[model samples]
Structure formats: C-alpha cells, structure tokens
Target: MGSLLFLAFAYLAVGQAAVNRNGAQTAADAAALAAAQDKRDQLAGKWVEEVLDPTQWQDIFDGFAPGLTPSCWRADQLASQNDAHVDGCVPGPLEFEVSVEMDNPVGDSIIPGTEGRYSTESAIAVIEPRCTFELPEEDAGDDVLPQLTCKDRNWDLDPEDLGDLPAPEDLFDVHLAD
Candidate 1:
C-alpha cells in the first residue's frame, strides 16, 4: 500500500511540472505574437500615411518604414496578462522572439526540490506581408492609388476616399514561427 501511494504522488508531481511547463510555453507564444502584431499594425499605419506614394509601398511591406516604434512593450504586457514575465524580447527584421518565465513556481509537491522550480520557455513570431501591389502603367494622378492584392482579397485604394483602406490584418499576417 505504501508503494502504491508513493507511485501516485510521483505521478502527481510529474503532472504538476508538465502543467507549469505548458503554461510557460503558452505565455511565451502569446508574448511573441503580441510583439509581431504590434509591429504589423504600425506598418499598416505607415502605409496609410504614404498611400499616395506608391514608391514607398514596397519598403513598408518589407518592414522598413520610417518613424516606427519598438514593439517589445507589447510582449511584456502580454506576458503579464498570461501570469508570466518576459525574460527576453528580441526584435529581428520581421520577427520577434520572446522568452517567458512563469510568475509562480510549481507548488509544494511530494517530490523534493519541486516547490522552487519555475518553467521558462521561448517562442518566435513572424510578421509576413500579405499585400502586393503593382504600380500603375500610367500615372494615375495623386488622387488614385494602385490596387493591392492581399491574401486573395483585392483592395482598390483611393487616396481621396480613404474610407475603405485595408486593415492591419489584411496587410500582414502574424503567426508563431514553427
């Protein structure tokens, strides 16, 4: 009977550790995605600002827009929301890598040294530009812009109208890197 009880406790301890590890990974994934999404939003905004200038569209889609801000703060906020803390946030060309540690350690368990153990995990999220536009063959004037095709959806953008602009999600896709 004592042996069975010990085995049960051992299983419980392993389950506890697994849960904590999963939580850490979840937090890291959320943090990385948040950072990438933030940058995607910023780029979309920049595109709107330069809508009339088709020459700048390629640069914007490539994630090299001017006046863009760092997105790591978003990672921190997301980690906190997930009951974790971001240990590192690194921004690359079009991706963000984040490492998170669980805010709470594994609770006291039958296994020794489990109470002080915290789980840390890392994830990478990428921002991929979804829109492609070909400059008009002829000068369409400042009031008109080229049609943009994003993820099979076409956007007929008009600088003068400015009401039906593509949203941030339409311009870029944010996903966890595998």
Candidate 2:
C-alpha cells in the first residue's frame, strides 16, 4: 500500500509537469501566430497609403517587439528588409521586405517602388492557430478507423486587409502630390 501511494504521487507530479509544459507551448504558438498576422495587416493598410521605407519597417517593431502578447509567444523586432543593410540602414536607400511569414491566402503581393515606396505581396499561412478539441467516434468496429472531426479556430488578419479603396492601384496610375 505504501508503494502504491508513492507511485500515485509520482504519477501526479509527472502529469503536472507535462501539463505545465504544454500550456507554455500553446501560449508561445498563439503569440507567434498573432504577431505575424497582426504585422501583416498593419503593412497591408499602410502599403496603399505610404511606402514601406526603412523608417516604416522600424515602425513595424514599435511597441509590439518583445515578449508575448495577451496570447503568449515571443515577439521581436524584425530587421529592415534590405539585406545589404545589416545595420538597418542602407546607403543605396532602403526598402521593405517580407521578413515575417504567415499562412497568407491572398498570395505574395510585392509592392513596387514608385515614389520611394513599393508594394509587397502579402503571404497568408496558418503561422499559429487556436486550439481545437477532438473526440473519438464510438462507432468504430474491428479493423475500422474512427473518423475524427477537425475544427479550425485559428488564424486571422487585420481589418486593413479588407479595406475598401477607390480601385486597385495596380489597375491605374493615380498620383497625388501630398
């Protein structure tokens, strides 16, 4: 009976450790995914209005750079896109880049340089996703596989991604001297 008690306590301690670790992982994944998508949305909105220059890239890191959001995961300041400028400043002028990756559905849209600013294709991929709980089907028989249901509550984009513009800029040239 004493041995059984010891075994029980050991089991409980190990289970607690495993659970704590998994919780940490979930938080980290959530934060990473959120930061990537959030950054993308911000860029998409600013793309049409202002060019993503060196300064602009710096702005991307802003206050969101460090630690995890309310959702967890680690966020850090990404360097400017110009590979030539390792110091975040380029001599031949600076440009933005797709440093962050996500499960983008709109595809890679690279904004071009027209008046010191250019466009970049947005990439959407499920960088981080929410938790999905699955249950086993009870109708499985011998040599039969049980069907599992998958629920996707993860992934997101900024409101700017859905912004309404007069028209697609690529379709025509409308220059403003602001």
Candidate 3:
C-alpha cells in the first residue's frame, strides 16, 4: 500500500512539471510572435510614409525609421500576460528570438532541486516582406508615379488602391521558425 501511494504521488508531480513546461513554451511562442508582428507593422508604416511623398521613398527604403515600439517591449508585455517573464529578447533583422521563464513553478516533487525551479523555453519567429518598391523613371511630365509591386500585383498611386492597400499581415508573413 505504501509503495503504491508513493508511486501515484510521484506520477502526479511529473505531470505537474510537464504542464508547467508546456505553459512556458506557450509563453515563449506568444512573445516571439508578438515581437515579430510589431516589426512587420513598422515596415508597413514606412511604406505608407513613402506613399504619401514619393520623393522620400528612396531614403525610407534604404534606411527606414526606427520602430515606434521596441520589439523587446512587446515581448515583455506578452510574457507577463501569459503568467511568465521574458528571460531574454533579441531582435535580428525582421526576426525576434525570445526566451521566457514561467513564474509559477511545478509543485515540489521527489526529484531533488525541483522545488522553486521555473521552466524556460525559447522560440524564434521570422517576418517575410511581401512587397517591393521600384522607383519610377524620371519624367519631364509633372506627374511622377512610383511602382508598388506586392503579391504579383502592380499598384499605382491610385487613391482607391491606396485606401485598399493590403493590411499589415498581408504585407508581412510572420511565423514560428522553431
């Protein structure tokens, strides 16, 4: 009877740890995705700014403005929302790698050092741009038009098309790489 009871308790503890580890993984995934999404939004905003004034388009394309919201900030916010804390957030060119540690630990178990130890998980997300800007040729005419190519569709500076421009998600593809 004593051995059976101990075995049951041990299984329960292992199950709890598994649950905590899964939660930590979830937090890391969410944080990474959020940061990547933020970067994608920044790219879309730059596209809009260039659209407003084609003259500044080259500069914007060559060297874009800094993001209004830092990727680390977005990751931290997401981790907290998931009952975890951001252990690390590193932004690479259109990608964010995040490591999160669970705030709630698995219950004490027979395994030594299991108490008060949090599970940590890491995830990576990448953003792929769906649009490319090709500068229009210099013209003598007053009207200067730039080419906006996205998703195999050429878009001019038409007000209706501009208004119907693809959403940020459409302009960028964000997904978990690992």
Worst 10 residues of 2 by lDDT: 84-93
* Candidate that would win on TM-score: 1
Segments in model 2 whose C-alpha atoms lie over 4 Å from true places:
50-178
lDDT by residue (tens digit), candidate 3, 1-178: 9999989988988998999999999999999999988877887787686565666645434335555467688899999999999999998877899999998877688877789899999999888776677555666333555666677676666634567665676567899995
> What is the per-residue lDDT of model 1 for residues 1-178, given as tens digits with 9 covering 90 to 100?
9999999999999999999999999999999999999999999999988888998999999999989999999999999999999999999868999999999998899988988989999999999999898997666666667899999699987676878888999899999999
- For each candidate, C-alpha RMSD in Å? 1.6, 25.7, 3.1
Candidate 2 accuracy as TM-score: 0.32
Q: After superposition, how far is residue 173 of candidate 2 from its true place, in Å?
A: 28
Could you estimate the TM-score for every candidate? 0.93, 0.32, 0.81
Q: Name the top lDDT candidate.
A: 1
lDDT of each: 0.92, 0.28, 0.79
- If the candidates were sorted by their lDDT against the true structure, best first, what order would they fall in? 1, 3, 2
